[model samples]
Target chain A: MTENNEYAVECEGLGRVYRSRSLLGQSRETVALQDLNLQIPKGTVFGVLGPNGAGKTTTIRILSTLLSATTGTARVLGYDVVKEGREVRKNIGIILGGDRGFYGRLTGKENLRYFAALNHIKPRDTDRIIDDSLAQAGLADQQKTLVEQYSRGMKQRLHVARGLLTDPGVVFMDEPTLGLDPLGAQELRQRIPALVGQGKTVLLTTHYMFEADSLCSRIAIINKGKLVALGTPAEIKRNFSSIGVIELTLNQTRPSLQEELTGLDGVKRATTSADGVYQKLTVHVVAGADLSDKIAEVVGKDHIENMVARDPTLEEAYLEIID
Target chain B: MRNFFVQAYLSYRGLFLWLNWTAYISNVVLRPILMLLMFALVGKFAADSDAAQAYMIGMIGYAIPVILLGGILQSFVYERVFGTISFIYSSPGSRVAVFFSRGVLHFPNSILACALSFLFGWLVLSLDLSTLNWWTMIVSVLLTAAACTAFALFLGNFTMMLGEFFNLYNAAMGLFLAMTGVIIPIASLPWFFGDLANGIPLTHGLVALRGAFAGMDIGAVRDELLLEALVGLGYAIAGIVVYMLVERDARARSSLERSPA
Candidate 1:
C-alpha cells in the first residue's frame, strides 16, 4: 500500500500469525488478525469495537510499530509501519492503558519526564510539554504523587497524558477505559473530542457500545480477525433498525421458552437471562410484528409481570452483527 | 546527548527501587562488606595473615561484578516486569543512547562498592595499605568496574529475552566467582578452564588489581589492564549487537512486553 494524505492510518490485507512450539515438540499457530483492511481519515475518531481476542490490540500494536505484521502493510501518516518504522514511530503515539505500564515508585510527573526523554523531547521543552499534557489530562494536581499511590482512574489518565507528550498527529488507544468507574469512564470519554479538536486522529478500541456510539464518527466491528461491520454508529444501527424488540419480565421461565419464541412467525432471535427472582426474555422481531399477545398466550399471562416494546439499540445491533 | 543523561538518570532512579536509604545501606553496602569480612576471616582461619590479605583483595575484586551485574540486570528486569520495555522499544529514541545509558549510573555504583569493600578490608581485616600503589589501584578499580559493567550489559539482553533474572544472575555470579580468580588463582586451574577464564570479564582485571596492590607500576600490569579494557569493549559491542537482534526478533514475534512462554 502507498501513503495517502487524506488518511491518517491505512492498512491493506494486514495479517498477523503467532506460532508457538511446546516443550513436547508440538506446534500451534494462532491467526490473531488476517486480511484486515482499514483507512481511517485524518482528524476523526475511528473506533474499533470487538469482542475479547478479536485482534483489536493486534491492530493497535502493528500501527504503533510495536509488532510487525506477518503479511501485508500498514502505514501511519503515510509512513509504512514496517519498512519506515522509525518515521512511523516519530509521528504516532500509543497508549496501552492498564495498571502495569508505569514505574510505581516514580511520581507521575517523573514518569512523564522519562518518557519525554524517550520521545526525544528537548530538555528545554520537556517540562512545559509535560505540564501541558498533565493539565490536559486533569492530572496536574497529582503530578507529584507516586504512581503507586494514585487510584486506577488517575493511572489511566496519566497514560493518556504520556501518549500526548509528543503531540503526534495520530494516537492509538487500546482499551483506555477498560477498568474505571462510571464517573471515571465518563470523564475520560469527555476528553476524546478535545483530542479531535486539536486535529489529532484517534483510533480507539473499546468494548463499550454506548461510548463508541457517542464518541466515534465511524466505527468498525471486527470478529474472528475480520471486519464484520463498518459504518457510522447511526448507519450501523440503521441496518438493524427494521428489527424491533419485545421484552417480558416473567416470574419464572422454562428452558423451552426460547425455542418456543424462536418458532414464532416474525421472531428473528430470542434470548433469556435471569435477573434475581425474575427471568427477562428478549425477542427480536420484524418491524410492526405484534407478537406480544401470542407470546403472552405461549408464556401464559399469569406468569408475565410486565412487557415493553422498543427499537433496537446500538448494543443490540452490534450483538446481531457479531452473532 | 542531554537526553541520554536524562534517560540514564531517570531510569536508574525509577527502576532501581533499592536506591532508598534503607535498602541501599542493607543490600548494597552492609551485605557486601559483611560477606567480605566473613570470607577474609575464613582465609585467616585456614592459613595466615598473607592468605587473609589475598582473600580480602579477591573479595574486593568480586564485589564489583556482583554489584554492577546485579544493578544492570535489575534495570532490564524491572523494565520488563513493569511493562515499560514495550514503550521504550516503540519510541523513536536512539537505541545506542538507551542501551548504553543503563550502565551509566551502575558503573559508579560498582566503584562505590569497591571502595567500601577496600575500606572494610583495611578497618576490619587489617589489610596492609602501605604497599598499595594508590594511582595504579585506582586505575585497576576503575577498569575492573567498567569491565564488569560492560559484561553485565552483555548479559542484560538475556535477562530481557529470557525473563529469568535470578537464574541468570546466580549462574553468572557462580561462573565469575569460580573462574575469574576471585578466590582461586587462574594459573592453578586446568588448562581448559584457564582458556575459558580468558574470555570472562574481570579475570585479567583481578590479576592487574592484585598486581597494583602488590605495589606494581602501571607498566608492569599494562598488558592485563589493556586486555581488560579490550574485553570490556568486546562485550559492549556484543551487547549492542545482541540487543538489536533481539529487538528485531521481538518486533517480528510480538514478544517485547514479556518473554514468550
Candidate 2:
C-alpha cells in the first residue's frame, strides 16, 4: 500500500451527458466530457483548460464522486469513482461548482465545522482542525464572521478553507479564483502553490490561460467534449505554433494590392480590414524559414507603418488545438 | 448502525429544536383558543345544552390531528426547501433512513404540543373526565395522533413532488379547519357533507375522538376508527413510495455537479 505509483486521478474514455427539459417539455442532451483519458500524477497541480460548457466542471464532478460517468471508468486515488466512492470522498476535498457554498445563516467557521462533523471527524478536534484550516487559507482572523457579510474575496478564501478542512490527499478546485479582483486572484495564485508544498495534489480548472500556465505543472485543453491537448504549457505552445501571425497596418497599400501580395512567395495569406488599408496576415513558413525580407519586399517598406509580429502564446496554442 | 444512530439522533434533535419555533407554539395555542371562542359564540346563539358542552369537552381531540399533522407536514416541507434533503441524499446513508428519520424528527414536538394543548382545552371548558367514555376518548386521542402523523407523510411526499415545500405547508394549513371533523362529527351531518367528511382521514380520527368523547356504541363507531387507522397507514405508505420514486428521479436528473472553469 506504500506509494510507488500514486495517481491522484485517472480516467479512461470518461464522458457525461447532461440532459435538460426543452421549452416544449422534451429532453435535450449536451455531451459534457467525451472519451477523455487523462492522468494526474500524485502531488502535482493539474490544470484543465476550456471555454464555457467545455466539460471542465463535469470532469471535476466525476473525479470528486459528485457525478457518475455516462460511460468509461474514472478512479481517484486508486478507488473507483462509482464503486468505491466513499473511500474516494474520504481522501479528496472538493470545492464544487465555483463558490456554491456556505449556508447564508451560518458563520464561516460554523459551516466548515458542520461539514467536518458530517465527515465524522471527532467533535473534540473540531476547533483545532477549523483553526488550522482557516489559518492555512489565510482566513484565520475573520473565521467568526457570517458568510453573507464576507466580501467576494473573503468568501473565496473561506471556500478554500472549507476544501482544506479535511487535510485530504487531493483537492479539486473548480474555478477557484473566478469573480475575483486582480489582487485577490494574485493572492490566491500565491496560496495554491503553498498547498503543493505540503505534498497535496490539486486539480484546478480555469479559462484563464495565465492561471494555467503560471500555476499548473501540466495542462489539458478540452473543447466540444473532447480533450484536444495535454502536456506542459510550454511544450503545447512550441508544438502547435505552425503559423507566424503578424499585424501589418498599412498607410498606403490598397485592398487589391494586399490581395495580390497574399500570392507572393513566403506570404501564406493576407486578410485586410473592411476599410481596406490595414490587414493582419499569417505566414506559413518552412520550418526555420526566415521570410522577413520577402514579406517586406511584397509590401513596400514605405507602405508598412506598423509591422507587429505577435508571438503565439498558450492561448494561440489552445486555439490551434481546438480549431 | 452508526449512520442509523446519527440519523436518528439528528431527527430527534430536529423535533426538539422545532419545539422552539414561534409559529409552532402560536399555532398550537391559537387553534384551541379559536375553537373555544367559536363555541362560546355559537352556544349563546343556539340554545345551550349538555351536548353542546360535550362538544366543547370533545374539541380537545380536534387539536391532536392538527397538532400532529401540522408538526409532521411543516417540517417535511421546510427541510425539503432548505436543501437539507439534498444534503442528506448525498450522504452515505440509505434513503429510507433519511425519510424515516424525518418522521422521527417531527414526532416529539407534535406529541408534546398536542398533549399540552388538549390539557389546556380542558382548563377552558371545565369538562368532567370521570366518564369511561371520556377515558376511551383519551386513548383514542393517542391513537389518532399517530394516525394524523402518518397521514402527513403524504403531504411531505407531495411537497417534494412539486419541488416546493412551503406551498404544501400552506395548502395543508389552509384545509385544516375544514378537512378534519374537529368542529362537527361527520355522522351527525346530513348526506354529502357526511360523505366528504368520511372521505378525509381527519374525518375518521375526529370521529374516533368524538366517539370516545360521547361513548357512542362501539359496534356503530368501530368502522370509522378502523378506517382512520387503515387510511392513515395507507396514505403514509403512499407518501413513502412517492418520496422514494422522486428520490431516484432527482438523483438521475442532477446537473448540480457542474464545476465552472
Candidate 2, residues A1-323, lDDT tens digits: the string is 22235788889989888788878999898898899998889889999988888999878867876667888988878888878877877788776434345554456787676566566666778789988888877778888786668887787777777777778888998898887778778887897888899988999998888888899999988888898888998877766545555566666655566566667765555556633654544444432446767777777888777776655568766765676
Error in Å for residue A297 of model 1: 7.6
lDDT of 2 by residue, B1-261 (tens): 454455555444443233555865576677655765566446546746564554554455555555656556655554544344444444444556556655664555555655665565567555544443755565566556666667677677665556444566666644554556565545566667767655556566666666665666555567777887787677768877877676555545552222212
* Candidate 1 lDDT over residue span B77-195, tens digit each: 78888889888888999888889999999888888888999998998779988888888889998998888888999999998888757889999999988999988889988769998
Using DockQ, give the best candidate's number.
1
The number of the candidate with the highest lDDT is: 1
Compared to the true structure, candidate 2 yields what TM-score? 0.73
lDDT string, candidate 1, A232-304, tens digits: 8988877645677899999988889889988989998888898789999999988788888998888889999
Give DockQ per model, in order.
0.74, 0.17
Clashes of 2: 1
- Global lDDT for candidate 1? 0.88
Off by over 4 Å in 2: A1-5, A20-27, A97-100, A240-311, B1-116, B123-158, B170-181, B184-247, B255-261
Flag regions of model 1 displaced more than 4 Å.
A240-260, A270-282, A286-311, B259-261
lDDT of 1 at A142: 99
